[model samples]
Target chain A: MKQSGTIVEKQYFTYGAAPDRLQLESGAVLGPVTIAYETFGTLNRDRDNVILIAHAFSGDSHVAGHYPTDREGDKPGWWDFMVGPGKGIDTDKYFVICPNILGSCMGSTGPKSINPETQKPYGLDFPMMTIGDMVTTQKALLDHLGISELRAVVGGSVGGMQVLEWCVRFPEMIRSAVPIATTMRHSALAIAFNEIARQSIMADPKWNNGDYYGGDFPRMGLAVARMVGHVTYLSDEAMRRKFGRRLQDKEAFSFGFFDGDFQVESYLRYQGSKFVDRFDANSLLYITKAADYFDVVDRVTASGPLKGGDLQKVKYLVISYSSDWLYPTYQAKELVQALKRTGQDVSFCEIEADCGHDAFLIPDERLTTLVKGFIDGVG
Target chain B: MKQSGTIVEKQYFTYGAAPDRLQLESGAVLGPVTIAYETFGTLNRDRDNVILIAHAFSGDSHVAGHYPTDREGDKPGWWDFMVGPGKGIDTDKYFVICPNILGSCMGSTGPKSINPETQKPYGLDFPMMTIGDMVTTQKALLDHLGISELRAVVGGSVGGMQVLEWCVRFPEMIRSAVPIATTMRHSALAIAFNEIARQSIMADPKWNNGDYYGGDFPRMGLAVARMVGHVTYLSDEAMRRKFGRRLQDKEAFSFGFFDGDFQVESYLRYQGSKFVDRFDANSLLYITKAADYFDVVDRVTASGPLKGGDLQKVKYLVISYSSDWLYPTYQAKELVQALKRTGQDVSFCEIEADCGHDAFLIPDERLTTLVKGFIDGVG
Candidate 1:
């Protein structure tokens, strides 16, 4: 995994006997696909000191310290603080592993991955994937890494969905589980936000039915989609406090309407433009659909409504932020309450924060202390 | 002077001693402006029964009832309830005159109107206008209509700003005044919304620096701008109630992001698309800027704040909607409280409604009843 100058390690593995076709919950079958992954910390002999972090949409396995060759501008990793030495999770003490989920553009088998039989990128013809399929793929990756158990499984938002998946799919595998700012079932409002973002991407004429690999990308629609998503990520109060009605340059109003007068407008435009530079539009659609399909309790209690679920083997830790409307604290409370009714060890905390849905990404001393204390208590 | 189809008798007049040169508050002048108006009912012998209804940003003299040549889809006017036969300010009694405000495309001499000197659209060369200049133009129109005294000057939002202006600039002319759901000064958030909308319009490449006339109009930018404004016109709860997570055509998710999935996205896109067909981009820019500059109290209110003097001669009524964030109820309360402080007869009511800023347009019996009772009580 070590290299000079922006090292992006790409490794591959074949999981299970390649079936003629593996059917997903959505009834789409994918066959004989290779999965890509990149490893970080070394696994201990006991394999019990492992932390499994799941990637959200548009994220990859780069969850901590930069590759030796990474350039200055490229972000080292999404969760640099928690995984670093002496930080929240502490890389020195615990082995950390993050897998780029299935149906993602980041070092994983996705729509862009070549179909072995056709030897071409599986564009729209790529099999549709459910959140369960994504979790199954992660399970395969963990098996390949020779890790049968984990100290903890931790994630936020869509990442939180994966953490829940790990618990239900293999309850004994996880000693502790932390699902932050996530929902048991996607709300109508949440679905609407995702649907709008998806439509914005799809409406772009440049999309060319998801096969525009060599041509100009659907930048405008993708930018609009990102703009919509970014709005949900930050609170209105946060935006007002940060930018307000401050102007870009001018004082008096320009009679002609051809300039940015307010700082908020400029900030949104900047956010949109920069997002299209790094993210793939198709990947956004696929990942959002995966998130939209996530609902773990329905499977666990299909016959009858579950007052609680079996969490005796798993010490559950749920966290939420006050201002996060995207996945509010109430959703986190539901999970904790469900586990409580099941007579399981569960701790839920709602943190006061102004960052909205993205609060989980920001370093809060209180949040870090809670996470560290909860994980240590589990041991 | 009433016809079956005609709402009111159309009237026009020329004033401002330097009739060829219209002087502005900023000491600027444009030549030979025309004002179009319509008067309902009849003026009293004392010329004191006249009530002036100030128009909003894009509104015209056609504030109530059917226009002489109004087509099927076109509304009678924005506020038909508050001014009609047996209505709020009953046309059978009190004389109500609503004039097309200056700097508007509708009948008023604006950027779209031909410049007498150049025989071309004023466009970008038109001098910037303030709220004061608009009130001044209205005064001249009132004088020509042979009304020395106004029983009341009533308005909401930008119209409310004009009502305040009339009270300040010509206190002797108004007997009673109503300024509803408006503020004497714009908040930073209000300014941010307007500025972002302007930026959305200018961002479109086809704007051609506001000279796209007789060519492909800047429809994309204009549509985007309208979409932004439409969002402000609606409360979050209203949007959620109307469009929520309802899917457009499909039941299951379309993994590809090309088509509209959610009803809200489709609704917003439809609203945006239809807006461009009816509205002129340049007019939108001008009108929004006018609204942004409409502060009754000057920005730097150091010692004595700007106030409408001698409200003893005027009775004031203010109305606001519960969910109207664009022009909140607090603003109407402020206007009413200010008038009361000056020992004026004032009444204020906040309507309970979910539609937000555009609630005034909806057919609400309470609004009609309250307005009618108030007008009759004043009479």
Candidate 2:
């Protein structure tokens, strides 16, 4: 079977047209929002067969398969290893839908997207948004697709936050949620890292107070930010195993002036440089702030219809990693406890992995078994 | 016992004065090099009643005591808590010598120092030095002080690296040594963090290829670098316990926007800004590079006079904090094993502490006991 033989034609849906617009969690209204999404597998007679897959930070709507224009050996969609036929997320079994989240730069309307009124990119003019606001846009896209109820929804990192948001705001719409390696709220350590990254970007004069559109971008600052993000994504053990103190290019260590460099340093520099090419600096600020502001427990339990000890109708399969210091296992258990208190069906698993926060994105046998069993078991 | 009443009059000793100038580890010759240092307590006639205290990155020779001009409520020396009459490394029992490490801007011939040849700040023109070079300068300072031997040498972090270097390069000059929260060489993870910090500093246009001296400094870039350094110096548990998700001012979270900031964010920003006042961005680059290039095992075991299995004349105490993930206990153990292989008398301890790499700087009773007992027992 050609799991990745399908051409990835970008599909978009516009919302907030006229009177009924998208109201953000901050009560701000987005004029007209566009969502870029991709679909895999055929929709069954019952639209309930649709499953929504959310992408993480630095992720996009391309979750599986290869575009027709791609050459041989070119990388497929982000989760092609896990979402192809007979894979963990098995596109053959479910019609998968992945959207380039709102406020992101990949074909979606975001800071770089032209503001309909000013005829210029939004830049910092882009209204502040929360994970809930992102979920609202996904919900509207589902509404347009006539997908009332989802078979399941899955995401890791920021994408996982979207899964939690979907469960909170539209519980009756989701059958099960798999929030992998993510937290309901960031800890101080996490916030500190994000702040450092944001500071790196804003420090660049080229940022020009977020109005550098159609001009020189804050490439250097954004690269530094990406370097920080890359460090957080990998565990110390993983890094040691991968690079250790090994010098770049297997060069001999010079006794004088320290000419040789560590492999890890160059690897991160490459990751940082690569990120600047595909991402917008302003989107990073907005998205990271949204992530820092995410507090599902507070949003739900603090004076909401789905308050603590209240009923939750969706089943949750929460997954965390052993070495994921960014979010860690304790945070996942805390989220599970919150769900259990709400009398919701919650299954928590702390998968032992040395890969840190990015483990969910990497293909693992146990992750495959757990996610496949959990989502497949869900009606 | 006016432990902190001793005025901190920074005394300078010039070496490399013409004919027999100091030779750097990198094979470069430095001329008219000066070391800024201070001594606590009186050096007895025996001279062996002396100890050396090395400082960490971002630290100066100010190991203890308040300057005479310092008013009430003013902060004392960095390690005033551990270096007073009745404290660890007791100045009452033995005189202590601390010189600002070479290649640092703390009154040392660093990148910010004027080039004798060019009559301008060296900046990028400054020659790179290794941890060994730093050790060499400390030796020169000790030699100039008319001290032939040291009763003990104690330091943590980069200071700890110096202790190890001293033992390796000048084993007969020290009777005992304490190296805390340090590694034989940097792990890939540690190198990655340092790279991020360097990248943050270099990203600023104000850095201007390290030629911004006597001009608009890279304050913003240096601040971001300090922020990254601050995060690494702290443990996750410490940050969580200190700040958690508490907002900066404890205000209601606006639904439409995130006005309430996490306390951690503001605290980091403040730290970043405060560091800009004291540190030189180019000096940070040089010192950190010196640290990354430190490899005691490679220096000692790989083609050196004091090769592995050779005799080491000094007793060694290696200490690491339980939560100091930057230079974790495992790294300390590795260093210990290397020493033991060389027939060196070594004692190792992984102290239980929630604080991270900066645990030694904090006033901890256990650290006090361990350091005090180690130094005194040597005599």
Candidate 3:
């Protein structure tokens, strides 16, 4: 239950520096790619006690604890409950690192970052990033730290895709993997939602084809996209239990065009508007495009079963939430099937939770126990 | 297998004339309301074979067959599959009436209609209309036709809500009722989707506070709203079976921000853009607001077991689809429970279909048979 104690410092590693640019999946090159990352605890002498935690879509490198500042009740890092001292991952025993994924605006080289050649923000000019590209940057950061083999690679939602990418692209670096509440690829329904979110962004004239860097932002479009994200992240049961037909302060219907004040409406609007301040619409379009294009099943199927490496060397623990219709439990099982077909060591569990895809981010006794047990068994 | 034969003419009836305005639930008054409706088949001498078919959200009075236009490939009516001469609500036997609900852009007097005082589009000035007002208009139309409802009333989705309103508000006017794929009230999840859809329209700059009647409409916002609606209307299974992860025209990923071209994306965009062409943005806001405000359970409970009406006189048929998550099967069952508690004769069936909320509108053998059998049992 203890915090990570002192705030972790966010360090940056600039790869593909200068003329030698990082070759993206689209055959385009991006240079001086800086990946923002933060690490808790310490790397062991063997450099084998590392656990990489990938962030979700629109997430940053700050995974746990707060930055050193003079503030009371400041919000802690995103996964503080699961990655702190004596917590599920036990930062005191293992070095835990989280890197901001590519195609995101969270201190990473994304659409908002300056193009080395043009000297302007990439905006729509940024090459589309893939999950493999994201994992490649993480591996680059690990190599820089002299950390070769990770004890485990863990992540949920879009972050989980990174864990799977690491499993296939660089299995030698992972002793174990935890891909939680994510799919090898998006189903058509998921694609529909993401497409709608993207359309919402593109529809805003303020977006100006993603070139609105210093002027008015596409606040409305980005907010709508975030609202769609929020709706998908939580399950029907969660919303039903949380808001139900509850109105705001008014006892009767507003009956006016713009003042119906349903509590859920207020919550979604707040979530959307707040997201507008922290996110870039172009980044959302790029990141979601990347996620929608991801398909681990094809890559794994093509690679064949684990190659020459021993199946026991790389372990995978697939976790899914029962109520996560966005990335339903069946998808996790599909992922498990794909992994097993590759002859990789795989363990699967469907956690009974009503919070939907966001369940892994929330603290639960069963989840903590399962994660701790898996980690303890790993190293 | 015959069509409705001749395309029925849309008829209009004016009621709630000026001076005596229709008092809305919000205490706002609207006057000289005009209800646009269409009728097929013939009313028997006893006026006892009437079957009122309410249309869904964004639907119109044209319930069966095509228009009077001479196009060879013209599309049929919205419910043509189930409302034709020899189909479910067989026009050959029962008199069928379909009324476009109030607060809609389709023929009915709505936000797009000219306000008497302003002599311009009501726009945001249009008073909010509820399911009750919609049913009230239909009742007025029936009175003008010198017909007393006897055979049955049928509808699905938002239309289903209207059907329920008619049951509780005018049980004495019915011999039976059919409400399909609907809820007595919206769940918080449903409310969340509706609220987000409303926000999408309101966020558009071209909306101009709903006064963009003679200028550029909020096409983008309205399209996004339609996209959201499309997502909710189809089931995950349906989407997966139809589109999967198929790409459009391209063999590989576009690797660009906007050209990923997942088939699902193409479909949703088309659906959204097409909706913008036919629908009024302000009407979506008002109609969804009214649907959100509807709570038949409260009104039904207050009426106390049909107000001592004969349980066998007015029968009820509640139908739901297996994969219609928007309304879901449980909501229909909930309506059944309430109807039974009120001592009204009720029959319930959950049709197994993977098409989601739109299943009832599509041609299905089981649904047609059920409707035919229920309507036959009525007269």
Candidate 4:
């Protein structure tokens, strides 16, 4: 099958029986978990060219290419800029697999998914998930795809956390790993932002304790949360260049009530309002919690790095942006240091960019070149 | 009267009524404005020993001493650390006057204050206020007190903005000016955070377009806003030191729904929940908007610096905390540069503190010394 241009459809892979349900990090189990995914490029006969792609907190299975033209807006995939036939991931040379994680709202078994026991939407009934559980669900999907070994796993931000988890969990199963603009564990500052975002959502009475499905969603709170998130994702320099002290419409200060005096305020309001239409508030709460719980130190200390094997088998490429304060260069350095201690083959680079944590999602020639070079080296 | 130790009573100064209403920067007028204030130390016969103390966004007129014990939870002044009899502002040597700004909710003419015409709270009906308007009203209070000139004006953060306004609007009347941890204008980053806070409050249906008084207030939204504000007030290092990966009420991650796993989350929630009790949401909206409109550049360029006189008579001591990214040291430096350009007598200091933008509010020996020395030199 030719895999290029756009993903025309979403695919699902389901597994795990009642007795052999997927065990979560919290000692809970989820049965018959369904994984929503999309793929690009042809799987080689050897099946060794399968590259698993994990997504960030708000991202879904649509990693690249335009959705079907029949869909309104016909928007391209979230990572459409990077994953294509001749792009950084090089779909022509490698089969790229992007899966919606366990607790995401997009076409995956999440809080919105129907519970087998109740035959109704899980809502808040969905068991709490962790980064480890998300990785395990993806691994199950890969197993069902008849792919025993993988070419690589790549992701940024929360996705990057999954990349790290993959390398440590199944050392020999992967050929390479690329985790960009992510931390092994969230800093208190990062967690604080996440907490505020969660509070914004929960504070909205419309949320109704996350059971507002088929009713009024917590759009207001979700928008505010997204607005806060957008601010963190862009650097101060970028915001200054983009919005500065420029006022919206009016040349002078309104000195009016709750008006958008600065262009940045108007921009944020727009961002927040627009975000609510495409995202789920409860999913945001769960995914951010999972990211917050991601701690490589804890994982390593509990089960030791790579168990009884050398980490040399897994090639690692760690990239961070200069202006990504959310997961700053220091965080990437910390992750690289951990890998180095395990005698892993690791290459790290801090890209010079002022786009902050969201730089990985934007198109940059330097990032493209680095990714291309790193992936080629893995071959 | 011994104006020392605990404050036994609150004083009120009423001015600008009916036809002689206080004209705002927006050309709106407010009448019969009452300024609630507190005074410390004795005013000498010369009356030239009066030092005006401006408060920050959420601060009140109570700059020092505890409230009367008759009231429950009679709290000490917000700036009790820096403005005691023997402290930084030195009540022993100079009489200190602190007035709740016109647009503040704490015993002042604000959104919560009754609209004399409507016989109900002004709510959103209150005219939009600026930092300049706040200073203008405070000047009215000073005029009512028979004070012709001020020995100095001291403030930090939004309070600092008021101090800057005092120096610019009444240059000859101020002997010295001390503006700490403040910016001449709000940066896009700063404005973005404030906008998020405002949006969080407005999102609540209970806000009722800022007319929620005599009903359930938008406590939830206001609390979330406070959480966002609290995050910006502390530095990453301070947060790390205070709540580094420490879970709340558990040894490890609960992976439960909305449990506030991290200690920082718990702290923020507590901060948010407690803030709503003492603060009015509408007041927060107005005060923050006022801070956003505080552009010293606009003042300078519009009327030209120092107008018809020299600025050499007004000594300036501008201070910034090392970790105050909300209104970073660079912003303070910018304010100093503006003063220097006009041949003004200016002193600037960046106090080495890890407490972030709130360093000025917290007790620090270095800050106290700098403040005391600056005030002493004013004489």
- Per-model TM-score on C-alpha atoms: 0.80, 0.95, 0.97, 0.96
- For candidate 1, the per-residue lDDT at B95 reads 86
Looking at candidate 4, what is the lDDT of residue A363?
Answer: 88
Q: Each prediction's Cα lDDT score? A: 0.72, 0.86, 0.86, 0.86
User: What's every prediction's RMSD, in angstroms?
Assistant: 5.1, 2.7, 2.1, 2.6
- lDDT per residue for candidate 3 within A116-214, as digits (tens), equals 879999988888888889888888888888888899999998999898889889876779999999999999998888888888888889999999999
Q: Which candidate is the best by DockQ?
A: 3
| TM-score winner between candidates 3 and 4 | 3
Question: How far off is model 3, as Cα RMSD?
Answer: 2.1
Model 2 alpha-carbon drift over 4 Å, by segment: A1-4, A253-260, A299-310, B1-4, B253-260, B299-310
TM-score of 1: 0.80
Write model 1 residue lDDT over A212-270, tens digit each, in one string: 77678878767776766776787655665876556677785554454655566567678
Measured by TM-score, how close is model 4 to the native structure? 0.96
lDDT of 3: 0.86
Tell me the TM-score that candidate 4 gets on chain A alone: 0.94
Kindly list the per-residue Cα lDDT of model 1 for residues B1-379, writing each as its tens digit. 2234335545665554345588765466886777778888878788777888888765788877776565665666678767777777788788888888777777777777776667777777677777778888888887776778887788877888888878767766776777766777565456656654565556455666676767787776666666666666777667768875567888966655556556765776788789888667777777777776676653212111334342234666788899887777776776666666656677888999998887776778988887777766775
Residue B39 displacement (Å), model 1: 4.6
Quote model 3's iRMS: 1.0
